[model samples]
Target: MKSVARKLSAVTLVVIALSNGATAFAQSKVTEIPVPNLVIYPGDLIEEGMLTQQRVLKRSIAGMPIHRHEDAILGKEAKRTLIPGHPIALNATREPLIVRRGTLAKLIFREDGLEIIAVVEPLQSGAVGETVKAKNLDTGLQVVGVVQEDGTLLVEGG
Candidate 1:
């Protein structure tokens, strides 16, 4: 009778432990950091604390050339004021290319320019009008070409 009672207590303890472990695992959460006010299109050189506005007439005061537009720049403040150029910064929403030297990556061309896609190889250094070698991961083909203003590498072959 004592042995049976011990066995029943051990089973109850095991079930409770398993239930607690399952609850702890299921209650786990992922936290994401808030992005800053910066909008960077592909091929835009990013400086710290720089943002791009969407209007054509609203100029940049920080001597950085405006590359793209944002929705906030279309407000009444932009229309009413004839400010020569406001201080601009890059938006944090856009992800920058992470390229490394001598690593293989795939080049995807968009309407703006090109995007180099590689899981291991991040784009380290590239400029506009400069030729870069991009390799397709699936086909393993090497494509050489010019880097456009929109941050895309225009390969010679299709």
Candidate 2:
């Protein structure tokens, strides 16, 4: 009977120690992250003024690409609905599309001091600096080009 009581005491101590450890973890360090001030729908642009700071448990965001800076999210379009006071995931937003699918844009090619410009219909839409496929309107030839900031496609080679 005495041995059983000692074992019970040891188990009680262990339980208490575990409970204390959990309490300490609950009060662990917090990180200040930016969150949306209101509901942000997909395709809506994120603005600096539309964000607010929130304190989150550090461990809760482990291995997550949560946005910590305003500059990282500013002027970006939301890819999913963002609720107020929730940390924004890095993949939740994207650069705004400068060129849309099936849109006619100028395709410029430069080689050996010669520059050639032609009209192209973008087969896919993309943002600046993104590569996409376009069809040359003049020659009906398929080509790959990088989308430019001005919504133009710049082709390389012939």
Candidate 3:
């Protein structure tokens, strides 16, 4: 009978320890982050009023760019559907597309304080400030350039 009582005591002690550990974990710090009001579809830019700060457990912040600036993430289009009350994960969104494939794009080359202008047909589509492939219409030479917000492509070193 005494042995059985000791075994029961040990189990009780283990359960108490586990409960205390869980309590400590629950009391850990949490932070508030911006979340959407509704399910945001892909390619929809996030607006300021669309999000509100929500308190979430610190563990959820892991693998997320929680420390990024508001403007850095705001106005970025969602790459996937974002559900309400859940913080948008980093890389879940991107800048809206500015250049489309098979379109004629103004290409600029900046070299040593000299600017050269040319027209190229883009072979691939890309968003503003993203690098994309474009082929020169005249020479048929393929070149890579960053798509500017003003529908211009900035090719480095011609």
lDDT winner among the candidates?
Answer: 2
State the lDDT of candidate 1 residue by residue for 35-148, as single tens digits.
224543344544434433333222222344432344432211111212223433333223333333466444654344544443222234454555666665566655555555
Candidate 3 yields a Cα-based lDDT of: 0.83
Top model number, TM-score: 2
Q: What is the full ranking by TM-score, best candidate first?
A: 2, 3, 1
Q: Which is better, 1 or 3, measured by lDDT?
A: 3
Tens-place lDDT per residue, model 2, 27-135, is 6767788999999999899987789998888888888888988889999999999999999999999999888888889899988778899999999989999999999
All models: lDDT?
0.44, 0.90, 0.83
- Can you tell me which runs of candidate 3 are displaced by over 4 Å? 1-28, 63-69, 110-116, 156-158
Clashing pairs in 3: none
Cα deviation of 60, candidate 1, in Å: 36
| lDDT tens digits, residue span 1-158, model 3 | 99999999999999999999998877675666777778899878888877777877777677676523457668788888988877777778887878889989999999989998999999998998789999999899998999998999997773
Could you give me the TM-score of model 3 versus the true structure?
A: 0.64
**Better-scoring candidate (TM-score), 1 or 3:** 3
Off by over 4 Å in 1: 1-124, 156-158
